[model samples]
Target chain A: MYGLIGKMRAARGQRDAVMDVLRETTGALPGCLSYVIAIDPVDADAIWVTEVWTDQASHKASLQLPEVQAAIAKARPFIAGFEFQVETRPVGGFGLPTAEPG
Target chain B: MYGLIGKMRAARGQRDAVMDVLRETTGALPGCLSYVIAIDPVDADAIWVTEVWTDQASHKASLQLPEVQAAIAKARPFIAGFEFQVETRPVGGFGLPTAEPG
Candidate 1:
């Protein structure tokens, strides 16, 4: 499955606000297996987003969903910067969907 | 729940070996809600492990499990370095268990 893990910064003193915006992304994002928003205990302004999807296209397509687009717009102001980003392929573990053989 | 997100580098030509070690960690970790091993698409030596547990104590206790201890020892040689580590509290998301009210 396609995976994305990234570190992001919230506007100064706005980490909680940014988290709220992300938490609202419970819209119908088909193929999205996991979309976790977590607070970084070490950095007040840092937040981590970890995502897993059935495929790359499913992930890309979710970006255009009206709800997702709206979330991006709403969260723009609170986003300060991104520290790092990486694309990944999930191997296996608990709480993840079983990957289908290609 | 307690959460941990970290980036790890595998020794040269041993990423898959390192992943195998981690993936074999499917032992009975009581409170481990999620433990995913993902490969970094951009870096051959980089891997990301995202984990969530019911509580801090559960996570801490897991380190002492025989299987986990064994895996750590087996993978130590192939483990090059840890790029970063962070503690977190998950707010909400899919593929995660609901947080119980305290």
Candidate 2:
């Protein structure tokens, strides 16, 4: 599976709002195994997003989806800038969404 | 829920070995909702661990479990050192472990 770990910084006092947009727009996407938005404890404005997908194509496809595009548009104003984006491969672990029967 | 995103550096040429131990020792942890091991794409020797738990106490308590302790011991030699550790609160997400029957 494909994985992405990225850090995003929100504008001052806008972290909650940014997360709200994320919550609204995320989920229900096919091929998404895991997608978590977390608050960075020390840096009040920083949020880390962890994502797991069945493959790279699936993740790329999600970005082109209307909901995700709307999320980016809605969240852009409150975002300061991204810190980093790292991609990886997930071999195995817990809490991954189970595969549905074909 | 409690979330942790950490970067661990492995000894030269030992990334797979380190991840191997992690895969063997990470699952079925009580209170652990997710524990994913991913390789940092840009850094050949670095790995990122993303974890979620039901609560802080449960996470802390797991450190004392024999399996966890054994994992630390078993993987230590191949570890270079931790780069960073960030704690986060997960307000909502996908692929988090569903609550078990009470």
Candidate 3:
């Protein structure tokens, strides 16, 4: 599986607002295994978004989805900056659902 | 549960070696729910370590464990630097075992 680990900084005091948009918009996406949104305890304006998709192609395809595109448009204004973004290969985990081979 | 999303940079060409140490050493820890280590596709020397613990106290306690200390000591040599570290609050997700209330 493919994974994305990244940090997004929200405009001052806007982290919760950004997270709400993320939660509301990430309802259903084809090939999405998991999409976790977390609050950064140390940096109030920072949030961590970790995603797992069936494959790189699935992840790439998600960007073109109307809902995803809308989400990006809606949340972009609150985003101040990004700290780091990394791609990963996920082996297996407890709560993650299995994905069909790509 | 408490979560940690962070990036660690290994010495040049040492990413795999560092991941091996992390996988070998993180066998069991009190209250540890998940510990995922992934390589950055774009940066060969960078690795993302995402952890989920039952609680803040449990996470703090882990640092004092002998095995954890040993693992840190063993892995420290290959560590080049940290990119970003963020603490998170995880509500729920697939594959993750439910953590007991703290």
Candidate 4:
């Protein structure tokens, strides 16, 4: 599976607002296995997003969706900056129900 | 539950080597729900690690374990640098089987 691990820094205390948009925006994409948004315990202004998709193409396609675009537009104002964006190939784990068949 | 999302840059083409160490090191710590390591698709020298634990204390305590400390020491040589480390409070999601009671 394809995975994305990244962090977004929100403006001042706007982290929750941005997280709301992210949670609302990430509707059921075709290949989405998991989409989790969490508040940074140490950095109050940071939000960490972890996503698991069936493949890289699915993740790319989701970005072009209208909802995603709208969400980006909505959250853009609160975003201070992005940090540590990395792509990954997920193997397997406890809560990963979408384990692809080999 | 507590979560950690971060990226580690490996030295030159040592990403895979570093990943191996990570996988080997993260062996069933108490309260550790998940520990996944993935390579950065775009960056050849980067690795992304996503971890979910029962609580912040568990994660902190794990770090002090002999095995964990040994793993860190073993992996340190290949680590180029760290980027985008964030602590998170996970709500709920698929594949995240360790969802705590509300």
Candidate 5:
């Protein structure tokens, strides 16, 4: 499985605007299985988006679409900058031998 | 399962310091099963932490411990602010019914 997470900042007063677009767009991504856009309850300005994709290549392909591009463009001005982190691993499902505390 | 995510900003140049403490402390939390601290590769000032705890009670109890308090005190100055988002759900497992794209 491949996961892509983006941590971004929304322009002052624009966080909800970006999330609205994201909610509208994510459900349609061809390879997106699970996607979450979580806003920090304490910091109204922070946003963290998590996406679980089938694979890295599929994810890269979706990023090329016109809609995706447009969404990014619309949201870019509101964003100060963002960090993208990607990880791929064989997740044997959740609760897999819960790690014992030391 | 109870999951708590905190998105915080590190004071200029103190990101590493906070992460260092988190890494050291998480392993000892009696109820912590999985903990991940991901730094935005694009935004050096942002940090997102994801933790899976056995339950809320267990998690709350840990916060009261002396070591945890000290760590929080030491890191507080380095934090600009943070938002906490908590969710509890029976996460049956991962990769469940990979959602189909519309």
Candidate 6:
């Protein structure tokens, strides 16, 4: 499985503004299976995102579009900087035990 | 599933040091079903982690332990900062569609 995980820092007091845009744009990305945003309790300005996507190609295509770029640009000012990682989990990767069918 | 997704910025030239500790300590986290660390290809010092845990209690306990604390301290110098999200996915949460048993 291919996924994107990353964190973005919101400008001193603009965290809420950034989050608003994230909530608005997530549903537009069809490739995204799950897109979650969370704030750090200890550091309020820190925002994190964990996303699972259909595949890298779809994700790459989504990023190249103008809509996504515009949303990112809107958030960039509030964000100090970001660190993120992209990875692929091999098929049958370990995690929650498979749920048994009822 | 209870998971932790976050990013940490490594101090200039210190990414490898932080990663080394992560690789070393993951097996010790029994609640952790998967612990992954990936570096942004575009930014060498940026590190991201996507983790899946058995539950929140187990994860909280792990964080309170001395070993984990010590590890965090060691990695802190290399890390500029972090933004992480902690979330729980309800049963049957979206994604991966379920694998068919052979």
Best by DockQ: 1
CAPRI grade of model 5? incorrect
Q: List model 3 lDDT by residue over B11-57, tens digit each.
A: 99888778878777665578877776667777788888778888989
Per-model tally of clashing residue pairs: 0, 0, 6, 2, 3, 2
Fraction of native contacts under 8 Å reproduced by each candidate: 0.75, 0.70, 0.31, 0.45, 0.02, 0.08
- Could you give candidate 1's per-residue lDDT for residues B3-100 as a string of tens digits? 99888999998999988888777544889877877888889999988888888999999899988899899999999999978888877777775632
Tens digits of per-residue lDDT for model 3 on A1-101? 89988888999989877887887766558888777777877778888878888899999999999988998999999999998777898654334557221
Model 2 DockQ, alpha carbons vs. true complex: 0.48
Ranking 2 against 5 by TM-score, winner:
2
Give candidate 6's error at residue A27 in angstroms: 0.2
TM-score of each: 0.90, 0.91, 0.73, 0.70, 0.50, 0.49
Candidates 3 and 6, the one with greater TM-score: 3
Model number with the top lDDT: 2
| B54: Cα error in model 1, Å | 1.4
Please provide the root mean square deviation of candidate 4 (C-alpha atoms, Å): 4.1
Candidate 2 C-alpha lDDT tens digits along A9-93: 9999999999889888777698998888888778899988888999999999999999889989999999999998889877677
Q: What is the C-alpha lDDT profile of model 2 across B1-102, one tens digit per residue?
A: 899988999999999999889888877789999888888777899988888999999999999999989989999999999998889887776777653211
Cα error, candidate 5, residue B56 (Å): 0.6
TM-score of chain B of 2: 0.93
For candidate 2, what is the lDDT?
A: 0.85
Q: Is the docking of candidate 2 incorrect, acceptable, medium or high quality?
A: acceptable
All candidates: DockQ: 0.55, 0.48, 0.26, 0.32, 0.09, 0.09
- Which of candidates 4 and 6 is the stronger one according to lDDT? 4
TM-score of chain A taken by itself, candidate 5 = 0.80
| lDDT tens digits, residue span A1-102, model 4 | 899877789999898888778766665677887777777777788887788888999999999998889989999999999976767887654345554211
Which ranges in model 4 have alpha carbons more than 4 Å from their true place?
A9-29, A42-45, A61-85, A91-95, A98-102, B100-102
The alpha-carbon lDDT assigned to residue A57 of candidate 2 equals 97
Name the 10 consecutive residues with the lowest summed lDDT in model 6 chain B. B93-102
lDDT of 1 at A10: 93
Q: In angstroms, give how far residue B96 of model 2 lies from its true place.
A: 1.0
